[model samples]
Target: MSAIQALSRQLYQSKLPWTFEFNFNEPDYIEQYWTHLGGDLTFNRPINMMSLPSHFIHEPLPGASATLATISHQQALQYMSAQHLQQSFLLSVHQYLMQNIQNNIQLEHTAEHFQMSSATLKRKLKKHQTHFQAQLDQSRLHTAIHLYRVHGFKTEQISQYLQINDTTNFRRAFKRWSGLTVQAAQS
Candidate 1:
Protein backbone atom coordinates (compact mmCIF):
# COMPACT_ATOMS: atom_id res chain seq x y z
CA MET A 1 0.00 0.00 0.00
CA SER A 2 2.76 2.45 0.85
CA ALA A 3 5.74 1.54 -1.34
CA ILE A 4 4.00 1.06 -4.68
CA GLN A 5 4.26 4.73 -5.63
CA ALA A 6 7.99 4.88 -5.00
CA LEU A 7 8.63 1.59 -6.77
CA SER A 8 6.54 2.60 -9.76
CA ARG A 9 8.48 5.86 -10.03
CA GLN A 10 11.56 3.83 -10.98
CA LEU A 11 10.24 1.29 -13.48
CA TYR A 12 7.11 2.62 -15.12
CA GLN A 13 5.81 5.63 -17.03
CA SER A 14 2.26 6.90 -16.59
CA LYS A 15 0.20 9.96 -17.40
CA LEU A 16 -1.12 10.65 -13.92
CA PRO A 17 -0.05 9.71 -10.41
CA TRP A 18 -1.27 6.28 -9.29
CA THR A 19 -3.82 5.91 -6.54
CA PHE A 20 -4.30 2.84 -4.34
CA GLU A 21 -7.30 1.45 -2.53
CA PHE A 22 -7.55 -1.48 -0.15
CA ASN A 23 -11.00 -3.15 -0.14
CA PHE A 24 -10.74 -4.84 3.26
CA ASN A 25 -12.96 -2.74 5.48
CA GLU A 26 -11.25 -2.83 8.83
CA PRO A 27 -11.75 -1.24 12.24
CA ASP A 28 -9.65 1.17 14.30
CA TYR A 29 -7.68 -1.46 16.24
CA ILE A 30 -6.57 -2.87 12.90
CA GLU A 31 -4.93 0.47 12.17
CA GLN A 32 -1.88 -0.55 14.20
CA TYR A 33 -1.17 -3.31 11.70
CA TRP A 34 -0.74 -0.71 8.96
CA THR A 35 1.21 1.99 10.84
CA HIS A 36 4.48 0.41 9.78
CA LEU A 37 3.45 1.06 6.17
CA GLY A 38 4.26 4.77 6.77
CA GLY A 39 2.13 7.75 7.80
CA ASP A 40 1.57 8.97 4.25
CA LEU A 41 -0.69 5.98 3.53
CA THR A 42 -3.61 7.01 5.75
CA PHE A 43 -5.84 7.69 2.77
CA ASN A 44 -8.68 5.16 2.64
CA ARG A 45 -11.88 5.04 0.60
CA PRO A 46 -15.22 3.28 0.22
CA ILE A 47 -15.29 3.16 4.00
CA ASN A 48 -18.55 1.19 4.05
CA MET A 49 -18.04 -1.82 1.82
CA MET A 50 -17.17 -5.13 3.40
CA SER A 51 -14.65 -6.46 0.89
CA LEU A 52 -13.73 -6.57 -2.79
CA PRO A 53 -10.86 -7.61 -4.97
CA SER A 54 -8.11 -4.98 -5.42
CA HIS A 55 -6.52 -4.30 -8.76
CA PHE A 56 -3.73 -2.08 -10.12
CA ILE A 57 -4.65 -0.43 -13.39
CA HIS A 58 -1.60 0.71 -15.33
CA GLU A 59 -0.79 1.48 -18.92
CA PRO A 60 1.35 -0.97 -20.87
CA LEU A 61 5.10 -0.59 -20.48
CA PRO A 62 6.27 1.88 -23.08
CA GLY A 63 9.93 1.20 -23.83
CA ALA A 64 12.20 -1.45 -25.41
CA SER A 65 13.20 -2.40 -21.86
CA ALA A 66 9.75 -3.89 -21.42
CA THR A 67 9.97 -5.66 -24.74
CA LEU A 68 13.33 -7.23 -23.90
CA ALA A 69 12.20 -8.38 -20.47
CA THR A 70 9.04 -9.89 -21.89
CA ILE A 71 10.91 -11.73 -24.63
CA SER A 72 13.51 -13.03 -22.18
CA HIS A 73 10.82 -14.25 -19.80
CA GLN A 74 9.01 -16.03 -22.61
CA GLN A 75 12.22 -17.68 -23.80
CA ALA A 76 12.98 -18.89 -20.28
CA LEU A 77 9.48 -20.34 -19.98
CA GLN A 78 9.75 -22.13 -23.31
CA TYR A 79 13.16 -23.51 -22.41
CA MET A 80 11.97 -24.75 -19.05
CA SER A 81 8.86 -26.29 -20.57
CA ALA A 82 10.71 -28.18 -23.31
CA GLN A 83 13.73 -29.29 -21.30
CA HIS A 84 12.31 -29.93 -17.83
CA LEU A 85 9.21 -32.07 -17.88
CA GLN A 86 10.11 -33.06 -14.35
CA GLN A 87 10.05 -29.44 -13.21
CA SER A 88 6.67 -28.95 -14.93
CA PHE A 89 5.30 -31.94 -13.04
CA LEU A 90 6.80 -30.70 -9.78
CA LEU A 91 5.38 -27.24 -10.50
CA SER A 92 1.88 -28.69 -10.77
CA VAL A 93 2.53 -30.56 -7.56
CA HIS A 94 3.75 -27.34 -5.97
CA GLN A 95 0.59 -25.51 -7.00
CA TYR A 96 -1.56 -28.32 -5.56
CA LEU A 97 0.41 -28.31 -2.34
CA MET A 98 0.14 -24.52 -2.02
CA GLN A 99 -3.60 -24.63 -2.66
CA ASN A 100 -3.96 -27.20 0.13
CA ILE A 101 -1.24 -25.92 2.43
CA GLN A 102 -3.56 -25.43 5.38
CA ASN A 103 -4.47 -29.13 5.28
CA ASN A 104 -2.37 -32.22 5.77
CA ILE A 105 -1.10 -33.25 2.35
CA GLN A 106 -0.45 -36.93 1.85
CA LEU A 107 1.25 -38.75 -1.00
CA GLU A 108 -1.86 -40.74 -1.85
CA HIS A 109 -4.04 -37.62 -1.99
CA THR A 110 -1.63 -35.82 -4.27
CA ALA A 111 -1.54 -38.90 -6.49
CA GLU A 112 -5.34 -38.87 -6.63
CA HIS A 113 -5.21 -35.26 -7.87
CA PHE A 114 -2.97 -36.34 -10.74
CA GLN A 115 -5.22 -39.29 -11.60
CA MET A 116 -2.55 -41.88 -10.78
CA SER A 117 -1.82 -44.47 -8.14
CA SER A 118 0.53 -43.47 -5.32
CA ALA A 119 3.14 -45.93 -6.49
CA THR A 120 3.02 -44.52 -9.99
CA LEU A 121 3.49 -41.03 -8.65
CA LYS A 122 6.42 -42.10 -6.52
CA ARG A 123 8.06 -43.85 -9.44
CA LYS A 124 7.62 -40.84 -11.67
CA LEU A 125 9.11 -38.52 -9.06
CA LYS A 126 11.98 -40.90 -8.48
CA LYS A 127 12.78 -40.80 -12.18
CA HIS A 128 13.01 -37.04 -11.84
CA GLN A 129 15.61 -37.49 -9.09
CA THR A 130 13.34 -35.95 -6.47
CA HIS A 131 10.49 -37.02 -4.24
CA PHE A 132 7.25 -35.85 -2.71
CA GLN A 133 8.61 -34.78 0.66
CA ALA A 134 10.97 -32.28 -0.96
CA GLN A 135 8.15 -30.83 -3.02
CA LEU A 136 5.98 -30.46 0.07
CA ASP A 137 8.76 -28.64 1.86
CA GLN A 138 9.29 -26.34 -1.11
CA SER A 139 5.61 -25.56 -1.30
CA ARG A 140 5.43 -24.79 2.39
CA LEU A 141 8.44 -22.52 2.09
CA HIS A 142 6.95 -20.69 -0.90
CA THR A 143 3.58 -20.24 0.78
CA ALA A 144 5.20 -19.01 3.94
CA ILE A 145 7.24 -16.45 2.04
CA HIS A 146 4.29 -15.23 -0.01
CA LEU A 147 2.08 -14.94 3.05
CA TYR A 148 4.59 -13.11 5.16
CA ARG A 149 6.06 -10.87 2.49
CA VAL A 150 3.15 -10.20 0.17
CA HIS A 151 0.23 -10.47 2.59
CA GLY A 152 1.91 -9.30 5.83
CA PHE A 153 1.01 -12.50 7.67
CA LYS A 154 2.53 -12.90 11.07
CA THR A 155 4.46 -15.98 12.17
CA GLU A 156 1.47 -17.47 13.95
CA GLN A 157 -0.83 -16.89 11.00
CA ILE A 158 1.69 -18.35 8.58
CA SER A 159 2.35 -21.28 10.90
CA GLN A 160 -1.32 -22.22 11.00
CA TYR A 161 -1.71 -21.65 7.28
CA LEU A 162 1.18 -24.02 6.49
CA GLN A 163 -0.23 -26.61 8.93
CA ILE A 164 2.96 -26.66 10.97
CA ASN A 165 0.91 -26.41 14.20
CA ASP A 166 4.03 -25.32 16.10
CA THR A 167 5.64 -21.92 15.64
CA THR A 168 9.22 -22.94 16.52
CA ASN A 169 9.35 -25.70 13.95
CA PHE A 170 7.93 -23.33 11.38
CA ARG A 171 10.60 -20.78 12.22
CA ARG A 172 13.35 -23.35 11.80
CA ALA A 173 11.83 -24.54 8.55
CA PHE A 174 11.65 -20.98 7.21
CA LYS A 175 15.26 -20.35 8.20
CA ARG A 176 16.35 -23.57 6.51
CA TRP A 177 14.36 -22.87 3.38
CA SER A 178 15.45 -19.29 2.71
CA GLY A 179 18.52 -18.76 4.88
CA LEU A 180 16.72 -15.77 6.39
CA THR A 181 14.33 -15.08 9.21
CA VAL A 182 10.72 -14.14 8.37
CA GLN A 183 11.22 -10.41 8.97
CA ALA A 184 14.54 -10.45 7.18
CA ALA A 185 12.93 -12.12 4.19
CA GLN A 186 10.80 -9.02 3.70
CA SER A 187 13.87 -6.89 3.11
Candidate 2:
Protein backbone atom coordinates (compact mmCIF):
# COMPACT_ATOMS: atom_id res chain seq x y z
CA MET A 1 0.00 0.00 0.00
CA SER A 2 1.08 3.61 -0.56
CA ALA A 3 2.13 5.77 2.35
CA ILE A 4 -0.97 7.91 2.17
CA GLN A 5 -3.23 4.91 2.05
CA ALA A 6 -1.28 3.42 4.85
CA LEU A 7 -1.64 6.65 6.78
CA SER A 8 -5.34 6.91 6.00
CA ARG A 9 -6.02 3.34 6.96
CA GLN A 10 -4.14 3.76 10.17
CA LEU A 11 -6.02 6.96 10.82
CA TYR A 12 -9.41 5.34 10.37
CA GLN A 13 -8.44 2.48 12.63
CA SER A 14 -6.97 4.58 15.39
CA LYS A 15 -9.23 4.58 18.46
CA LEU A 16 -8.28 7.88 19.99
CA PRO A 17 -8.81 11.30 18.46
CA TRP A 18 -5.78 13.38 17.41
CA THR A 19 -4.77 16.03 14.94
CA PHE A 20 -1.76 15.37 12.71
CA GLU A 21 0.63 17.87 11.20
CA PHE A 22 2.57 17.33 7.98
CA ASN A 23 6.18 18.04 7.19
CA PHE A 24 5.82 20.10 4.02
CA ASN A 25 9.42 21.34 3.60
CA GLU A 26 10.81 18.10 2.28
CA PRO A 27 9.90 18.18 -1.37
CA ASP A 28 10.76 14.52 -1.75
CA TYR A 29 8.35 13.36 0.93
CA ILE A 30 5.62 15.72 -0.20
CA GLU A 31 6.13 14.69 -3.81
CA GLN A 32 6.03 11.01 -2.96
CA TYR A 33 2.91 11.60 -0.89
CA TRP A 34 1.07 13.39 -3.64
CA THR A 35 2.29 10.83 -6.17
CA HIS A 36 1.10 7.91 -4.13
CA LEU A 37 -2.05 9.53 -2.83
CA GLY A 38 -3.28 10.98 -6.12
CA GLY A 39 -2.67 14.69 -5.42
CA ASP A 40 -5.58 15.05 -3.00
CA LEU A 41 -3.54 15.09 0.17
CA THR A 42 -1.42 18.03 1.27
CA PHE A 43 -0.35 19.83 4.40
CA ASN A 44 -1.94 23.21 4.19
CA ARG A 45 -3.14 25.80 6.64
CA PRO A 46 -6.89 26.20 6.38
CA ILE A 47 -8.83 29.44 6.14
CA ASN A 48 -10.04 31.29 9.23
CA MET A 49 -11.23 29.02 12.03
CA MET A 50 -11.28 25.95 9.83
CA SER A 51 -10.22 22.57 11.21
CA LEU A 52 -8.97 19.27 9.87
CA PRO A 53 -9.88 15.65 10.24
CA SER A 54 -9.01 14.19 13.60
CA HIS A 55 -6.71 11.58 12.18
CA PHE A 56 -4.49 13.76 10.01
CA ILE A 57 -3.94 16.84 12.22
CA HIS A 58 -1.98 17.62 15.34
CA GLU A 59 0.71 19.85 16.77
CA PRO A 60 4.15 19.44 15.24
CA LEU A 61 5.81 16.28 16.32
CA PRO A 62 8.30 17.10 19.04
CA GLY A 63 11.47 18.72 17.74
CA ALA A 64 10.58 17.93 14.14
CA SER A 65 11.27 21.49 12.98
CA ALA A 66 12.05 20.68 9.34
CA THR A 67 8.31 20.56 8.88
CA LEU A 68 5.63 20.97 11.50
CA ALA A 69 2.99 18.27 11.64
CA THR A 70 0.39 16.84 13.98
CA ILE A 71 -1.98 13.90 14.43
CA SER A 72 -5.26 14.75 16.21
CA HIS A 73 -9.07 15.03 15.86
CA GLN A 74 -9.88 17.73 18.36
CA GLN A 75 -10.46 20.30 15.68
CA ALA A 76 -12.94 18.21 13.71
CA LEU A 77 -16.07 20.03 14.87
CA GLN A 78 -14.37 23.37 14.51
CA TYR A 79 -13.63 22.47 10.94
CA MET A 80 -17.22 21.40 10.42
CA SER A 81 -18.52 24.66 11.80
CA ALA A 82 -16.11 26.61 9.66
CA GLN A 83 -17.27 24.77 6.58
CA HIS A 84 -20.89 25.42 7.44
CA LEU A 85 -20.32 29.14 7.94
CA GLN A 86 -21.49 31.42 5.16
CA GLN A 87 -19.10 32.25 2.33
CA SER A 88 -16.44 29.81 3.37
CA PHE A 89 -14.40 28.50 0.48
CA LEU A 90 -16.18 25.18 0.79
CA LEU A 91 -19.53 26.91 0.89
CA SER A 92 -18.64 28.87 -2.19
CA VAL A 93 -17.62 25.70 -3.92
CA HIS A 94 -20.75 24.02 -2.63
CA GLN A 95 -22.98 26.76 -3.98
CA TYR A 96 -21.21 26.72 -7.32
CA LEU A 97 -21.39 22.96 -7.50
CA MET A 98 -25.06 23.01 -6.62
CA GLN A 99 -25.88 25.59 -9.26
CA ASN A 100 -24.05 23.54 -11.87
CA ILE A 101 -25.30 20.21 -10.64
CA GLN A 102 -28.79 21.52 -11.19
CA ASN A 103 -27.74 22.28 -14.75
CA ASN A 104 -25.89 18.98 -15.10
CA ILE A 105 -22.40 20.51 -15.21
CA GLN A 106 -19.48 18.28 -14.39
CA LEU A 107 -17.43 18.64 -11.20
CA GLU A 108 -14.21 19.08 -13.14
CA HIS A 109 -15.76 21.97 -15.02
CA THR A 110 -16.92 23.59 -11.81
CA ALA A 111 -13.50 23.17 -10.24
CA GLU A 112 -11.89 24.80 -13.20
CA HIS A 113 -14.24 27.79 -13.37
CA PHE A 114 -13.35 28.63 -9.78
CA GLN A 115 -9.60 28.77 -10.66
CA MET A 116 -8.89 25.94 -8.31
CA SER A 117 -6.44 23.27 -9.29
CA SER A 118 -8.17 19.97 -8.61
CA ALA A 119 -5.52 18.93 -6.15
CA THR A 120 -5.51 22.27 -4.37
CA LEU A 121 -9.25 22.26 -4.09
CA LYS A 122 -9.32 18.73 -2.82
CA ARG A 123 -6.60 19.38 -0.29
CA LYS A 124 -8.27 22.52 0.98
CA LEU A 125 -11.51 20.72 1.52
CA LYS A 126 -9.66 17.89 3.19
CA LYS A 127 -7.99 20.37 5.48
CA HIS A 128 -11.47 21.51 6.41
CA GLN A 129 -12.27 17.89 7.34
CA THR A 130 -14.48 16.78 4.46
CA HIS A 131 -14.06 15.34 1.00
CA PHE A 132 -15.46 16.47 -2.33
CA GLN A 133 -17.65 13.39 -2.38
CA ALA A 134 -19.03 14.29 1.02
CA GLN A 135 -19.57 17.91 0.08
CA LEU A 136 -21.43 16.92 -3.07
CA ASP A 137 -23.42 14.46 -1.08
CA GLN A 138 -24.22 17.20 1.42
CA SER A 139 -25.41 19.46 -1.34
CA ARG A 140 -27.72 16.77 -2.59
CA LEU A 141 -28.89 16.15 0.90
CA HIS A 142 -29.68 19.83 1.30
CA THR A 143 -31.79 19.65 -1.82
CA ALA A 144 -33.47 16.44 -0.81
CA ILE A 145 -34.44 17.72 2.60
CA HIS A 146 -35.64 21.04 1.29
CA LEU A 147 -37.72 19.52 -1.47
CA TYR A 148 -39.12 16.79 0.69
CA ARG A 149 -40.02 19.02 3.60
CA VAL A 150 -40.25 22.62 2.47
CA HIS A 151 -40.77 22.63 -1.30
CA GLY A 152 -42.74 19.39 -1.62
CA PHE A 153 -41.04 17.59 -4.50
CA LYS A 154 -41.64 13.88 -4.94
CA THR A 155 -38.91 11.40 -4.19
CA GLU A 156 -38.45 10.16 -7.73
CA GLN A 157 -38.38 13.64 -9.19
CA ILE A 158 -36.07 14.81 -6.45
CA SER A 159 -33.80 11.90 -7.19
CA GLN A 160 -33.73 12.82 -10.85
CA TYR A 161 -33.17 16.50 -10.13
CA LEU A 162 -30.35 15.74 -7.77
CA GLN A 163 -28.70 13.38 -10.30
CA ILE A 164 -28.61 10.57 -7.85
CA ASN A 165 -28.52 7.60 -10.20
CA ASP A 166 -28.70 5.05 -7.46
CA THR A 167 -31.69 5.30 -5.17
CA THR A 168 -29.73 3.42 -2.56
CA ASN A 169 -26.89 5.96 -2.39
CA PHE A 170 -29.40 8.77 -2.06
CA ARG A 171 -31.21 7.06 0.74
CA ARG A 172 -27.99 6.15 2.49
CA ALA A 173 -26.51 9.62 2.24
CA PHE A 174 -29.74 11.25 3.35
CA LYS A 175 -29.90 9.17 6.48
CA ARG A 176 -26.23 9.75 7.16
CA TRP A 177 -26.68 13.48 6.88
CA SER A 178 -29.98 14.00 8.65
CA GLY A 179 -30.23 11.06 11.04
CA LEU A 180 -33.55 10.21 9.46
CA THR A 181 -34.89 8.89 6.19
CA VAL A 182 -36.00 11.29 3.49
CA GLN A 183 -39.61 10.35 4.00
CA ALA A 184 -39.26 10.86 7.72
CA ALA A 185 -37.71 14.22 7.11
CA GLN A 186 -40.71 15.31 5.08
CA SER A 187 -43.03 14.48 7.91
User: Model 1, which residues run further than 4 Å from truth?
Assistant: 1-87
For model 1, name the residue pairs that clash.
Answer: none
Q: Across residues 1-187, which tens digit of lDDT does each residue of candidate 2 receive?
A: 3544456546455322223323233355566654554444424211111124443456433334342233234366567677884467887878887776676655567678878788877888889999887777677766675566446788777878877787777777677765667665553
Per-residue lDDT tens digits for candidate 1, residues 1-187, read 3355445545566322433333244456656644533332322331111111234333454464866888999999998789874547877887898888888899999999999999999998999898999788777876876676458898999988887869998888877765567666544
The candidate scoring highest on TM-score is: 1
How high is the CA lDDT of each candidate model? 0.67, 0.60
* lDDT over C-alpha atoms for residue 99 of model 2: 73
